[model samples]
Target chain A: MKRNPWRDIRLHGTVLVLVVIAELIGTIKIPITQDVAITIMPLIYTIILGLAFYLIKPIKWIHRKQARIAEGAMMLFIGVLIAKLAVSSGQSIGLIFEMGPALILQELGHLATILVLPIALLLGFKKEAIGMTNSIGREPNVAVVVDKYGFNSPESRGVFAIFIIGTVIGTIFISFLVTFSLSFLPLHPYAFAMASGVGSASMNAAAIGPTLAAFPGLETQIEAFAGFSNLLSFCVGIYIVIFVALPLTEKIYNWLEPKIGRESIMPKKEDEEDA
Target chain B: MPDLIDGSENVSVHGIMNWIFLLAIFSIITVIGNYLGYHHPMESSIVGMAILSLITLAGVWLERYLPFNISSILYISVIGIILAFPGMPTSEFVLHYVSQIELLSIVTVFLAYVGIGMGKSWDEFKALGWRAVVITVLVIAATYYGAAIVAHIVLVLTGVPAA
Candidate 1:
């Protein structure tokens, strides 16, 4: 029956105000070529605002809590805006339907562990190292790993390591990759957008932003597909990691580790346990 | 004497007021966004906010009633689909104005919040050291290119136009 403090209106109101200013700043554009131009871009400024709140003493002291509070407040809008996009996407239902296979296939990208784990093993990474970098590092991935492997397992360190990397730089990395790939690839933007939503909000933003820049007309469909696909990723991602991705990685590791020779930078788990 | 106001759990003045406050802010910001970004009529932005606010509220209440929790995004998304159904009344208007909503600009707010959230974890990151960095880079590249390759193949096979 107790009220939640995070729901305080003053805190949410402050975030909304700051976000409006940031949005205005991000919306401003400058022409670069006959057809192309550059702009402030929202994600860039948002990160700056976040960094400022995080690093600056006064701002961190005064606004850090509000910034955190604002994060939750803004989540409400994400659904609303995505819904608005879905409404606009009705015209493209046929296209979305046709692209269903592509959307699901694209989501496989989030199962990074399946592909990366074997390679990490082949490259002389310790057996424990493979599990850490294999899956798309997100909130739930940690839970699944801890549950399956136990918190003290050598692999847990890998999960924690990648989890931090995923948290700190994942969004920016995904955004840049999306933008860069678009420059050369013949892939559809919707496919990329759906791929971006692989259960991480910032990564979704990074993926959607560049595609939005490239193909403005398809914005609604792209947003809708990405949003829906993200929801799917969130709902099913844990199971995928626990069952499909993890099992597949283990099989690959079992096959490759013997061939690669198990020399590794990390101390051997068996040796550590023995000591 | 009959009770002037019924004491029911469903009736919440505070909830209504909160939604109104949010709706007002959303409408004002949407107007500014339209001016700076989409250039839609001011009236459309206001109307769009009102409609969206209502949809959000409905989604919230719907979630409360559902046997299992459904995400608000999906709930509102279903509402959006029904509203935008072909030949439905106001479907055209909903289509026109929803397009004018600056979703990307709004997304910036979420990303900023995420950054702030990440910043709060500076110590944990510092402690993880460089191994995490290498792993992160590889994981990101692996996921992105892996997905991109699949997408590219699908697009090529479906003939949906390649980059």
Candidate 2:
């Protein structure tokens, strides 16, 4: 019942207006390779994947017993070792024959990226360097909200489910719209961040540069945006979702109170049907 | 290598199994991708994962399986690196799939994940926050530009065509 002031500011409102102002004013001269790789190509991938995989949940991934994880990992490792082996072999082979060092090195890099994630994560978190590991996938905001609601209601679950859908769709929708807009002007993620109020001014453009480079000539802008947009989105989006969702959570609490089998929060209303 | 079903204390048997299953589909897709080559890698990977997941889903619905499933997911991620290389002319192979895929969307996914991760690790982020986030974006953005800038400057300063 207490009002949260930040809710009224509308996080994006501040960031978006500044972004448009900046992009409209700034001028940039970009290097061609960076321009293409960072902006055009990456942006193209982002937009395309957004449309295709946006609705498809990323979390529900392949899960199986005795899956080929080790085999797959080993394959990746072997692929890397082969590349290193090829390096030595290809060197003598190339010097003796007339080929290139590119192949072996390329093979190694590819294998490395694929195989490195697990090892990297394991190493990265060797001693709880990252966080209070307990917080990995949990949401503190949601927990607090649940505690405040203090009722077990099926309707609450229903609303929360819808909220999940909303969050996902909203994320996707914003991505789609931003990409569409990106197609037109020489825009970047910085513009999106500033304009959308997602995170920082230039971050979005920077990050987007590589992804959208496929579009040609738009790489610079796209890469810049990636740098800032996501952070802004995270901050603003969370603030917005919490501010909006929690207040209505009471209704959610009431609706779900009856449907759920558990009784914990609110006292049950005892009424005589005969009366 | 840890077993697909089991892992060390740092990892878990349960978690390993889950990731292993993902790796299985990822491996299938990877094989398909290799066969398809750089061009159709994304498409092939997506299709392979989808088919595997769908079959798995059907099994679950039929009561022959369990539902704590990574019940549905698909992605075609690895091909980009293969497609992008110096001296290798932009072959029709590269051109074909590159045109179809949307790289920006993927970046957004990552950015969103980073955002979520930052939120999850608020303490870490708060300490570094704007400075770290900005620096990361700069480095990444500059990577695109830095490579070119360094190359260009090297050539200009040396009065040689770096190319």
Q: Which candidate wins on DockQ?
A: 1
Residues A100-128, candidate 1: write the lDDT tens digits: 68776666766754656655665556655
Q: Write down the worst ten-residue block by lDDT for model 1 chain B.
A: B1-10
Per-residue CA lDDT of model 2 for A124-222, tens digit only, reads: 211111111111101222222222231122222222222222232322333343455456544323333233322222323433443454345545543
| Candidate 2, residue B94: lDDT | 43
Query: DockQ numbers for every candidate?
Result: 0.23, 0.07
Candidate 2 lDDT by residue in tens digits, B57-118: 33223332344532111011112222223233532344343333222222222222222212
Whole-structure CA lDDT of model 1: 0.59
Model 1: share of real contacts kept: 0.46
**Residue B136 Cα positional deviation in candidate 1, in Å, after optimal superposition:** 5.1
